[model samples]
Target: MMMPAAPETDAVRLREAMTESLKTSGALDDPAWRAAVAAVPRHRFVPGFYLPAQEPDEHGLTVWEPVTADADYGRWLAAAYSDRTLITQFDEQEPDWAAPRVRHGGTPTSSATLPSLVLRMWADAGIAEGHAVLEIGTGSGYSTALACERLGSAGITSLDADPKRLETAATALHSCGYTPTLAVADGWYGYWPEAHFDRVVAVCSFRAVPPALIAQTRPGGKILLTLSGWMYGYARVLLTVSGDGTAEGTLLPGTVSFMSARSHAAPAFGNPAHWVAGLPEKARPVRHGPERITAATAEAFHLRYLAQCAVPDAQLTTFEDTVVLVDVVSGSAASLTPRGPGWDVREAGPVRLWERIEGVLDAFDASGRPGPGRFRLCVRGDEQFLSHPRLPSLPLPSVGYGRASTTGPSASRRMPGSGR
Candidate 1:
């Protein structure tokens, strides 16, 4: 009699499925990367994660419930193998994995990013064998494990700002038979001890490229990260460090949003009521044409980015027919609403917020409507400026304004709210 075929393990089957899906989806192009994904056991890294509660409790509030592999192996394994992000922490607090309970109302603080996104960013980095890679934001250590498999443990160093997160990641990474250098430090500072890295990959987003990252990366080395701002718009960018400590690069084609780097996260806005408590202290109606750039269309991605670049600390919100812009630091607010063939503009505080927005929208429209890819970023020392071939250079507010003001009716006045 022929020997019976061996049984297939769940982990192996799930891994194969995920790898094949990534390949079919065009996310995993390289065989080596596919192998790395297959070899690393992601389920081992995320023992527990938060899922949206199915139904609100008697209190009528939606919440996130913790699910663990031990509590429901089949369900947890299914989720682990799915091609989606898994929230591992809420408000920077670790979930009690052992307890089968729900936590009420908190924003996601950390997560194991979607597998396809992680692989795509790695592909963008184009890491070579034996390349020294420094990974910022080592959440759950899944990406770290993938890096270790591709570059070997000796070539990888992972850092995070949370000591608790680092401790947990260390345990999880060790369980997978890999031990890369793990550090608890603010990623904004870029671990200086491991300077001159061949590549730097930041899993977290920030308002601007950290100067220390450029200092630590070797000339010609690439840094891949997502640029995000208070408006919640994000663009993935790949920058190459120059010999003079300056870095220049273009925004990538796709959209990728990550949690803001811990040190760069904006201060809490607290209650929504507090934000919209009072009417505009002063309001005057102005006439303008219907918005040529909006947050609803495909081109809106670049428009929103331009807006954020123009107004650094402005918060943008959209209702059915109105766009609300507010800069808490400057106490400036604007409401742009549709009015027949034109727009009704209301402004408050010292800054001409509505006029500034109109100027940006008009500039963007006049520039042949270039996409994010057409924009280039140049960073020298502490200042960063964005430029497009068709448009004039615009300095990011994080750095002092480099060119004369072109904001609005008060073109000579300094733009308000000028910090990350």
Candidate 2:
């Protein structure tokens, strides 16, 4: 592959913006991370060309980038540095491959995740000087670069499932002057070359803590991961590797959405029989707006918590007229059933998922609205616990998301399940 022409001006602007933003976000406080973020030009790794548009009041966000255009490349480079997410893969269009691949708006296989979240994970990992770090999912080597900048090249090993992505990352890292060990392998398996490390960071989501991850860490090592559980949403968990390789940590503030590791890809949609057998008990049937909750609760931390509880197999499916969320494990489903007045929730399963959720809301209601400050999380082995200042805070008896229940035979549209 030919090296794309450099955009010096764009790189300068990105460096300024990122430096300022990191300063404001306190990410610049650490000299190593500051130098790393400042030294790396976000544009060099992303060679795409983004089209721009204007709106009445606000500018249209650079939604997608053309991978091969040289003239309009600045936008791509700018976005690469900005806090925005740069989608690196969608369906068959691998950004590392040749250009003109038709893009879809469905799932994202890889991305340089938002900067704030990136720093948050880095801080959560608690890496000290010379700490050996193993990173899962080396997308574009952006985070890997940051790790190298912090841990140095000899202490970092980054892995990804796709060889193409790893190749691109390797090239990008070498060009940027960092040589972390790069491997094309499933992140779930982790890297066995190194038995123990001071830190482990997973940029992807997992159904549960993998045994391999735990086994790879030495006692007292910290494992930073985005865990799926049954709390308010998905949480960034900071776990301490135990002597026996088992680890546990409390949920941190903030949220992130990540592609699940390839080895633990979400399962297929449900059949009527399967749904019937997996129904959540005590669930009530009602109409509610599914999109409202989905958008408001896009926090990966909370989603991960819920997945750990009520609906371990919960997935979100959005359609033209309806938004569906199903907990296949509990045979429960929640749909934003449209009514004349507005959208109400129609939920059915073994447990009254809405009532249980309302129970949490009610606790919040009783306590007034408890913000993040009032929230406290505690975890013990498989038992993860949470409490906040608010209404109906129930000690979640299970670990999962509440599923969307559907029983009607007249249903028309449906798609694959989204494992939260």
Candidate 3:
């Protein structure tokens, strides 16, 4: 009879397999990235993770079950080496991996972002040998370990708001022979004491590029992060910081998303019904039907993003027949119901949500319906705006154009692959 292999042997085998898989998939095109992937053990970083159950628990939110290494090392190691975003924390609470445990009705505050994603972002940022890197969001430290393999531990500085996560990442990095700088601070602010990093890569999405990032980065350095919105639109951008404290860049082709930074996240707005409760009917008829705006067509998908530009503060919710836009902070709400030829629109509060969305949609159509890919972003100090050759430059989430929240981007649309 054959004896079982040691855990270390299995870990090496699995890590090799995962690296090969990433290379085959084109995620690890650079040999240096591949070597880093091959060298650093991913299983060391993610000891366990949470997977959602098919049925939600008492709370309406999905309940996630924990898989732990102490309970089953074989399974945990296999999964850790896989190419998936492992849910590490739910509302700041790491799952009780002591046994099979579950968390319900809580948001994924942090995670070990997918391996391909880590490699992809590193490639996009052009992280290289001898270049110092500042990584935002050090969850499990898997990405940081890969960076260590590429640039050595001394060249990397990574931070997270959660001290526990940083502690865990530090332990994991040490085990893999990496002891990079791991600090506990809000990633949105960047590492304050450190300055002049060659590349700043954020695993989390931001509503606007933090001005602190531009100030800290070397004049020609790059800031790689996803620019998300209240509508949950993801635009991964690579910004090159300038000496004048201004940064500008074009959107990367792919749709990449991460959980919004706590500061940039949509404000908490409870119950859509509360905002739509009592709104007066519109006095004038509108030109277009709400059907066009609430549509399932490609145009509607694009329209959702366009609406995000116009009304940064309104959260959208849909019912069987009607769609509602509620801006809890502004005390503004728009209710759309069917009428004979057009939609019956109602409004309450300071801003007219429907009229704004209509105006944006009209402009989008008139601009020949440009896809989001053609857009460019310019960041100067605090404000950031989206620009295209034809369309107008619209303010992004940071400036607080208006106060809106997100129950989600839309009831019908699924959040992208990032899971955050």
> lDDT tens string, model 3, 237-312?
8898888888989877655679988767777777766666777754456656666645766556555666777788
Better of 1 and 2 by lDDT: 1
Q: Give each model's clash number.
A: 0, 71, 2
Q: In model 3, which runs have C-alpha deviations exceeding 4 angstroms?
A: 1-5, 55-60, 282-303, 319-321, 337-344, 398-420
lDDT of 2 by residue, 34-150 (tens): 777887766666655223233222342234434543443544565677876667776424654344543323456777777767777887788878788888888878888887876
Poorest lDDT segment (10 consecutive residues) of candidate 3: 411-420
Candidate 1 lDDT score at position 322: 67
What TM value does model 2 have?
0.73
**lDDT value, residue 202 of candidate 1:** 93
Tally clashes: model 2. 71
Given candidate 1, what's the lDDT at residue 76? 76
Worst-scoring 10-residue span by lDDT in model 1 = 411-420
